[model samples]
Structure formats: C-alpha cells, structure tokens
Target: MAYGVENALAVCCFMTPEYQESKNCQKELLYADEQNVPIIPCRIRSDWKPSSWLVPELPTKQFAHLAISNKSKSGVLRKTFLIGNTHKELTRKTAHGNTSEWTFFVRPPSSDRDSIETYIKRIRVYLHKTFSPPLVILDRSPFEITRTGWGEFEIRVIIEFQDEWHHEDLEIFWNLTLRDNESYEEVDVEFDSYL
Candidate 1:
C-alpha cells in the first residue's frame, strides 16, 4: 500500500533485519539507488563503507562520512527545536494529505542551563528527521533572564526577525529583576531604569 501511493520519482525501501540495529540512512539510501532515485544519507558511518555510489557525493560533510546536499546546506531541519532552562520540550510534526500528526512536545524541564548547548547541538544532529517543513515547534521563547550589576554591559540583539519567519503577530517583550546582595531581597521592574 505504501508503494502504491508513492511517487515514481520517490525512493521506496524495506528495513532489512541486518539494518534493524542501525540508525544509519545509508542502507535505505542504497535501496533508493536501486530505484534510480536520488538518496540523501544523513551521515556516513566509519564502520560501514558506502556499498555503492548511489547518489552524487555532496561537497560538504555533515555527520561523519555523510554528505549533505545543497537543499540541506542551510540546516533548516535542525533549527525547528528550542533549547532553554525552565522550559524545554521537543515536538515534531508529520503530515500526509489532509491528516497531520504532531510529535513535538516539551517533555523535559529545562533545569540544566549548562547543558543547553549540548542539547541544542544534539537536536541539530537529527536533521534527517526534519527533511520536511516545521518538524519541530518550540514554545514562545527559550530560556531568558536579565541579571544586572551596579553597571550595565554591552549586548547584541536583532530588533526584528528574519524575513522567512511569520513575525507579524508575535509580540516579544522582556522584564528585568533586581536582587539585593546583602538581604537577598527581590524586586521586579518593567523598565531597567527603575532598577
């Protein structure tokens, strides 16, 4: 039934038992090669030699021996997820015809700020899963906090987002907090000047 609905230009494949333990995309790509369709291997595994010259080799390497194509050069798939502390969950969505399924979720709490970079990098590593659009959906913003001392420090931020994003309806605002050193008293201020 899957084959009946697939495009002639698309690559069809079967999961060989040998590949059951492997998360490598090469095996399925090899199958696509048999169908004369272009295959995009997520990454190359040192242990596995590319069995055949299935698709044209991409000039850049993504993961290990895996070559990423021109379409994937921008790393669009990996940018969908958000990483932060206090609020962090991953949600992925897949759609077919009129029926759409959403797998994205904020499963784990963002308690480890130190590990945020590692978490985000790992999310980017799974770009293969998001070949399609908007596979990941994050909550409003990631972890954000403002800590000010007696003096101010220089910072950089874009007042607006890139053109590709739908920012028309989005409202972005920030709040500042002041914590007393001696008493450890806390005060919330909408404007930085008040603190």
Candidate 2:
C-alpha cells in the first residue's frame, strides 16, 4: 500500500508484506479507498532494486490519472503497455458461493487491423498456462482476448506489441477482484477504459 499518488491516481509497485507495514501507508490506503481513487499495480522483477520511479511526484491538479510505463535502459521508447479489468456478476454459481467474475482485457487506446490480431494471439499464448479451456477470442470488433475467473487472484499479464520493438515482455501484476451489484457503480466501466 506504499503507493505513489499522482493526480489522485494511486500507483503502487508489486506489493510485498513489508511495503504495507508502515502506518503512513496504511493511512494512505484508507484515504485512497475512501476517495474512490483508482489503484494501478505495477509489476517489477522480485530482484529489481527500488528506484525513483517507485515514488512519483506530488500532484498539482485536483483530478489526475496514473500511467505506469517501463522504459528501456536507455530511457527511450516505453516497452510497457496497458491492461484493464472489469467485474460483473455471473448468473451461474460457483462451488464457493455466489459467483462473480472479473475479466482482464488489453484494449489498447487504438490499434490497426494487424496490431489487433497480433495482440489477440499474444494474449492467448500468455494465458495458455493459467486459463484452462483457453480464453475465447471474438472474431469481430474490439479485437481482444478476455479471461474470467471466479475469485480475486494475481495474474501476470504479459504484453508485447505487434512490432516487437522490445525484446523483453512487459508484465503487469493484476489482482482481479470480484465486484457485486452493491459494490459496482455505473462509472466503473467508463473508468476502466482509461487504464
């Protein structure tokens, strides 16, 4: 919960128990939760050392959003990409209880025909190991691969652009939380698009 607050957008690195130990962080988490600010979780290698990027600059505007990007060693073009999460209630029930599922999608702000296909394929390969029966790929508009799960769990989302400009895959550690009617607002989908 030691998050970098910018533009009211809270960006926290791959969390560890130690990161959430501080009383100050606990306060920030509670405050952010109360404010209904969006939290973006950025995944980094376990061995990667802390850096300036972990703590972002203070916000100057009342409303702000967080954009987490990973730059190459040279700090040129960003090697990172974005993913989004949406939770909805499933009519079916799970063994645990009422089953609500969260869907993770990679809908880039924009993309060409070729790029969209590449993204779908890439996502399919990325999710192969974890998502049994595989993710269903829609053959129509908004070309993207989506996977749903009953519970909130951390899933590694690996992104590689069509060009493959960057050799290494950028990983996003996403904790997909289940949302129900009482917890969800109409604005949730609208808010997710930006992420």
Candidate 3:
C-alpha cells in the first residue's frame, strides 16, 4: 500500500469512519504526506468527518462527494477538425509565402448536440501573435475559426460552459497548417444533468 501510494500521481482518500480508525490507512496517509503527494479527500459518507490522527494530516476543505447513480450516462465524445487550403499568388511572392486559409471546427455527435448546445456558453480561439486581434469568441453554434495566413502555428481553443453548469472550460490545441489536408482530434467529456 505504501509502495502504491509512493508511485501514484494523486491519492484519492475516501473519508469514512472505518478508514480513519484503520492503522494501515494511517501509515499510507503519512507516507503519502512525507513523499509530498497530493491527497484528494473524497466524502463517502455525508456525516463523516476527519478525527483522531487525521486531524493534522487533512486540511479543512470541501471534500468531493463520490455520487454514483445507475441512471447517469457516460461521457460524450466530440471531434475537432482543422482543414487547410493553400493558394499561390500570381504576383512576385515566393512559393513559401503563399496564402493559406484554415478553418477549425468543433463538432458534437448528432445524438448529443442538444445537450452540448445547452451547456456550452461560448468558444474562444487564440491565434498567433501576428494576427490582428488574436482572440476570437463565438457565442453561438457552428463553432469554428477561419483565418488566412502565410505560415503555420499553434492555435488554442477553449470551450466555456454556462455559469449554472459549474464546469471547467474545455481546452484544446490545433496546429494551423498550410498543407492541403485535414486533421481531426477527439475528446470525451462528461456533463452533469440538472434533472
């Protein structure tokens, strides 16, 4: 148990009366503290609180509740694609300096579109510093970013949820390219239902 705690990225400590009274659990918690590992306190029982040896080790913070429901659905899978089209000018510009138009899209599954549209508040896309007003915010559907450039750079995309949802903004990255090809990336996200 100590070995497992030492190698773990973060320890999920389930707060319960029995867990606090166990000697082995105390040793594992102490070893994790000594190793400077992050301990995430999870509340299994609503009425349980840290006492005895746990008082000094656990900080006074809102513990995450482990709520399991048989009716709760799994995460939704969404795809983000980047498509680039390059065109060479007939003027005195070189081949490397050809202008390229790129479009970035965030598409949800057809079955989950309604849920995504209801929860998502806005989409923000960050472009290269060279572009005028590098930040673009879209508050409606067809979440996309279109830009014409002469070079390739990394683009940052952030999907913000409604204030009532209490969800962290989803962030994604795409490489803006001048190549005549399309790139796709997918992410799975779980959203809590109000019902």
lDDT of 2: 0.43
On a 0 to 1 TM-score scale, where does candidate 3 land against the true structure? 0.50
Residues 1-195, model 2: lDDT tens digits: 434453555544343334545556556645665566755444332333333333442233132223333332232332123455667777888665647665555653443223444433354323434566544433433534444455566555554434323234445555555653312111101111111
* lDDT score of residue 135 within candidate 1: 26
Better of 1 and 3 by TM-score: 3
Q: Which parts of model 1 have CA positions greater than 4 angstroms off?
A: 5-66, 69-75, 78-142, 153-195
lDDT of 3 by residue, 1-195 (tens): 877888999888877777778887788777888888888878755667778677777765457987744345532223333222223223444455545556776766556536456767898888888877999998887777666667778888888987655568988787765564566655665554421
TM-score of each: 0.21, 0.36, 0.50
> lDDT for every model?
0.28, 0.43, 0.68
- The numbered model that scores best in lDDT is 3
Query: Considering summed lDDT, which 10 consecutive residues are worst modelled in model 2?
Result: 185-194
TM-score quality measure for candidate 2: 0.36
Which wins on TM-score, candidate 1 or candidate 2?
A: 2
89-164 per-residue lDDT for model 1 (tens digits): 1243224221222121111233433333322211211112223432223323332332212221222211222223
Ranking by TM-score: 3, 2, 1
**RMSD in Å for model 1:** 21.1
